[model samples]
Target: MTATDLPAKPYRNTAFDASINNPSAYASTLDDSFAAIDWQASWLCHLNQLGYISKSISQLRGLKNDPAQTEKLEHTPDIIAKVLNTALQKHADALQQSLPQTKPALNNQAQTLKFVSQNELPEGEAYERFIGTTGNIPTRDNLHDLFNGSIWLTFPKTKALLNYYHMLEIKEQGIGASRGRVRDTITVFDENGAILVTAESSIGKALVDFDWQESLVAPRDKWDEPKQLNKQAQAAVYIFGHALLEKLLHPRKALCAHSIVINVTQDFFTLSLSERINHLDQKVADYMDALLSEPDVSPRKLSPLPILGVPHYWAENVQPSFYEDSQVFRSGRRSQS
Candidate 1:
């Protein structure tokens, strides 16, 4: 019999058709009759929708075109779910494999904590502990994960140094307080991007003295117009931390020693995924010389600066009520102390 004339599979069964109404029931009906490649593609699409998998539309289409396993099968929701679970497991395995073999020692404690894989970090006590002590762990296959993985690979020492300080804070202050402090010092919001830093002793106080409320929170008629908005000072404050951190790694002209901000324009998103990764890789390499000169892996004595979400990327920023209930833009009377 020709491949096209092969007997109908479970995917084409009438029971499968009726099971579509109840996804849980449908998944139980799935057998090995369904083509593996078709199932994988369907499952990936579902993952993309649920934010578990991050891939460009073009890449996803390419996966669907796998010629080796071509069998027509309707993509039922249940089938998609099964495929997604499989894909997630595979991705988790890959991530775990990519992690460094030597886990860092924590809190003068000789016992080392296993590096939690991305899939296992969404919930549970382990996730909470990881976030509380180590800062944020990026979700697998997402842009944040990609960037974070790059950061870890490029600046293993600096990344570990940051995590050590984060753990120390958690040990001293409770997780709640420690997390708040981390939000202030680092940009956990990968979508908008973040700049983190420790200001030089001389300029630290001055940097925090500005009236951020009046400058960043006030309502404006043309919020989208960059020129119309008076946010340079706020921008300076936001980027200062990142600039300062970079400067510490590589000290250059004294005049240029202070922090500077790098804006991620809309153009940045236009680049291909590999290009985006390369761009950031090159940016870090530019400062590798300075980062290498650091005397040791010990944590630097630095204060947590204010955290600023990327304004340009925030959809709410264009609305009139953007700053109305914003915790970040709220008065700093309590924080200033």
Candidate 2:
């Protein structure tokens, strides 16, 4: 496959299909124009009648809908949030409660919690601990917090793990002015992380080396991989940070991802969308575990991805000249190319 032939979306939920009975909308594909699409309506319309979402997303289309509210989307932070759906905004508050506590590393059991005001957090109480022990994620009525809650639903394990680490750091350092390296790493990722998966290491290396032309344009077919099962695609980006997703709502070239790249196995290409999400979540969690284990591993290290540069993610990326804008696809830390 060539660049033009690259798959539009790596995981499933590419667009409305025969399931929705609307071939025209299914054909437009919400992927074609990010800025032109309607977040409230057009986005929700493309889902597979009833579906789910994932953090790095075989599913952030992970979103399912109520037939009555097909056009309406509401935000509720409850684990039982199955009714309200538009763009993967469901089961946020309650998803955290359903977690199995994945490992002993975490001190608290994931259980039911109700949404409260952000102000409810005690002044000296660390935010992570408050959520860990009380099981309540004090939510504010805002997009940032709303996105944060929704991500919890998409990838509960990864989100819980992040919180555990944050709580651990806070306990050791007592929430000082300096959050230290671990918290900083978690914060950076939690705020702007995206999981970049490619079958070839060279593709990931090209991205980290700031070789935008090759990573983002060349070998584009690698990202799209030959489709199998009518849904499979090779490399993909599953947005982990709510902030990053919020930024994508407006869609700009300069926007970037603090990406962690994983060179996946061929089996990964064959798994269903939900399976892919679980795999990526575990991989990212393992990466975080490594960051905690080896001090010299550079917790601060993450590849910078000009997110829009992903093939077919942004309509403007179709032109070879799109990568020419040095402002977005800079060479490296050095200003000179």
Candidate 3:
């Protein structure tokens, strides 16, 4: 490869407390676990470079200034809300929304935050009803909730739209044992949704048609910053799932995302980071808007994307042989004549 073929940036992670990946802050340690994360494993250090990833790290202050303060820096709901709110306010008005303050773990309830009495909002009102009507997200202090809150900050519009649809379902079905197809689709996407933006609609079609090699392999170089996955390039993945983000913290080859495909113009690759994020935010929200417009929606609208196999996101994929793992990169849902 010529000099021009080389990527402009190198892998380096100067910020973010790696220990924040730990599920609990209560763990005692001085063993350099804080810096042990494989920050540079993703090409161009993409994982380390995500702006919201660091923002979700609430313990950065205590850990950076003094490792001893790990115990002192508890991620209470109020703190997590403030952190999310501060991060959200940094964006445009569309991204701006008030985070509900964290309520203490009342009546010996473990791992709870920003909660209300079970008697507070009728019997069946949970995730959607509480958020939609009471305007309060019933949460408790915990790692999982933190990741969910992080996603809300990242994709406020999409999250709100998901809640809106869930409320519609609840109104129709009344939170029965069976959530019906539409609710199931909303839940699946809410918990593990991602948006894959490609300049070419054919590329998106390849993924939807389960043309794994065509979408993931042959077009590998065409992905965002093939030379260095962080820079401006063709396509990008915007992860909107909080659970998926949590799983990615300790990235494994098996991890995947239920991805929504949004094809954009060829010039998309040239936009700034903020511009891309805002554009994807609006784009995905618009897609979700149209999706929920129909009463009968299906999770099939989302395509399966083995997130690790995304171009340079995982180092193992640098060698084409990595895609040979059929368990991870399956052949397809293609037809039989």
> How many residue pairs clash per model?
3, 12, 7
Which should have the higher TM-score, number 1 or number 2?
Answer: 2
Ranking by lDDT: 3, 2, 1
Please give me the total number of clashing residue pairs in predicted model 1.
3
Q: Which candidate is the best by TM-score?
A: 3
C-alpha-based local distance difference test score of model 1: 0.32
Q: Tell me the deviation in Å of residue 233 in model 1.
A: 26
Q: What TM-score does candidate 3 get on C-alpha atoms?
A: 0.71
Candidate 3, 161-232: lDDT as tens digits: 677777666777886789888888888888888778888777788888777787888888778853344343
Ranking by TM-score: 3, 2, 1
lDDT of 2 by residue, 18-79 (tens): 22233222111122222332343211211221243222122212232224333343332222
Maximum-lDDT candidate: 3
- lDDT (Cα, tens digit) per residue for candidate 1, span 36-108: 2222221112121223222222233333454432343334333332333333334334444322211233544
RMSD of 2: 11.8
> Can you give the TM-score per candidate against the true fold?
0.30, 0.68, 0.71
**Higher-scoring candidate on lDDT, 1 or 2:** 2
TM-score: which is higher, 1 or 3?
3
Worst ten in a row by lDDT for model 1: 41-50
